[model samples]
Target chain A: MTRLDMFIDRMVSQRACLDFAIAETALMGGPVFELGLGNGRTYDHLRDRVTGRPIYVFERAVASNPASTPPEDMTILGDVRETLPQAVGRFGDTASLIHADLGGHNLAKNDEFARLVSPLIAPLLAPGGLMVSSDRMYFDALEQVPLPTGAVEGRCFIYRRPTA
Target chain B: MTRLDMFIDRMVSQRACLDFAIAETALMGGPVFELGLGNGRTYDHLRDRVTGRPIYVFERAVASNPASTPPEDMTILGDVRETLPQAVGRFGDTASLIHADLGGHNLAKNDEFARLVSPLIAPLLAPGGLMVSSDRMYFDALEQVPLPTGAVEGRCFIYRRPTA
Candidate 1:
């Protein structure tokens, strides 16, 4: 089996929702950026869908990880916080999607990170572009606080740039 | 077992994704709209989740079919195409998240219906509210297309309104 198949089998077993989010973003059309490019899971998930558009991933050690790196043509890898400026320079306002699955290590710092990164990604988003993050920052609060019927859990918070 | 229990079981068997979606939306603080209120399945999934906000539903014939009517307090039901004016007036700008599992009939008109209702729901969404729909729409496409690694067909599309 191919590496993609092995990764997919693991994801299915773990029931990762990232694939769903990626597909939804792709259906909306995307040149996505993945923060916390853990094992390059989402990069693989989105590679085919956003064929021509480069999938930029930010992992502090991506360059050193052979298993996670893609063909030179499909992906760009670097540290998101430090390398974002260079990424913006290379792409020049073309990013349409952003995914952050950075593990629990940085969860508490999300608001701070968002403050910095949101502006960078915001300008690059096409008309209906989206940013999807995996961490359920509000899961506990939502359970304690009642919501309207038809409410669900585990939706990655999606931020959309205004379409005008 | 209570009606809710039975409904939850059914959802677990057939619409687990929808159930998860509703829970996640609620946790994220949503005012959700469900377009196809079939036998009140989605409503029941979110019954406990509904707190201060109203859950709006559009069913073609909930009034005629007692089984389809959601519990009195949780849902507002009507025809989407014809009664949107009244529905929007009643719900006002509180319709943040919109979901439709209307099967083939509704799926066929998704693009048109989404265009029509998006404006009304757009204003109601809190900064990160979601709009979701499920159908067999992606089944054939998913079969023909090989998803890149780490991807599986979640078979749902979620759209988020632009937040100002």
Candidate 2:
């Protein structure tokens, strides 16, 4: 598959895995975290797919379509490195799902960023919570999960915090 | 696959699903609840697969292998209907994973039992927790999950309480 095909496949796979994750962890009634605002289509999709759950959006700067922009309190602005810690202080391992779509031209930088930020995510997700991202990430506290059926590996990475 | 092959497939499939469920919810750090203790084999597998997490076994009587019988504090004896309710009062939505292998020679009776017990599982599981069972069960609070890649759907079922 071409890069474009892979990208679209990743998104479709992400939606499927997300449905599984949500069903698996729903009783937790925890907030959903979105890292990177971009066009807010994913945010919009998330809100529609999982109703009644709080979705907090973290954006370096707001550039989303006006129709898709999250409400003020739900949107966190500025550097993610700073905002994420603030979020941890407030949400603190109560987030049921977190989606980080921060992949870009800089492959090495993306890897660096993923490595740096993944550890911070552990404290923000509830046990059994899911973390989905475009780029691969690793953290001792998180466990990788298989993709949905028909989802090609390496396109979209899925991880979960063990219920332990 | 032959019935014997299918039966073996179901066990292998169950192990895979259990691993996924465990990875997804380990941070909950609650007990793993085993609903049936047939021969104590699966219970032994549960203990070996997940160390550090407490494993609670519910059996109608003590007929399990001596090596696999859970300690007194972890084993609940008597009729499941009565013991289960008591378990709910004590565990109360703290169980991260519940594996119910209550199937028997009487399919109809097993189905009846599953229907009767399905609802009781919700209060014992943490929100977003998992229920891996042999009988097909449906509850409004629990969302059914897709089976693993190679698993036959009707043989084993997975469910999760809605995060709400």
Top-scoring candidate (TM-score): 2
Model 1, B1-164: lDDT tens digits are 22222223323333434444455456554466667765454555544445555666667766423533666555555556555566656556555456666654244476555556555544444555555555323221112222222222445555554445
Candidate 2 structure quality by residue, lDDT tens digits, B33-120? 9998877767777787676689988888878767677899888887778888898888888888999998875679999988898777
Q: What ranges in model 2 sit over 4 Å off? A: B1-164
Per-residue lDDT over A1-164 for candidate 1, one digit per residue giving the tens place of the 0 to 100 score = 22222222333322233344444456554467767655554565555445555676667656323434666554455556656777767666556666666653344586566556655555555655555654433321112222222333432455555555
**Each model's DockQ?**
0.01, 0.01
Second chain TM-score per prediction?
Answer: 0.57, 0.92
CAPRI-style class, candidate 2 = incorrect
Best by lDDT: 2
lDDT of 1: 0.50
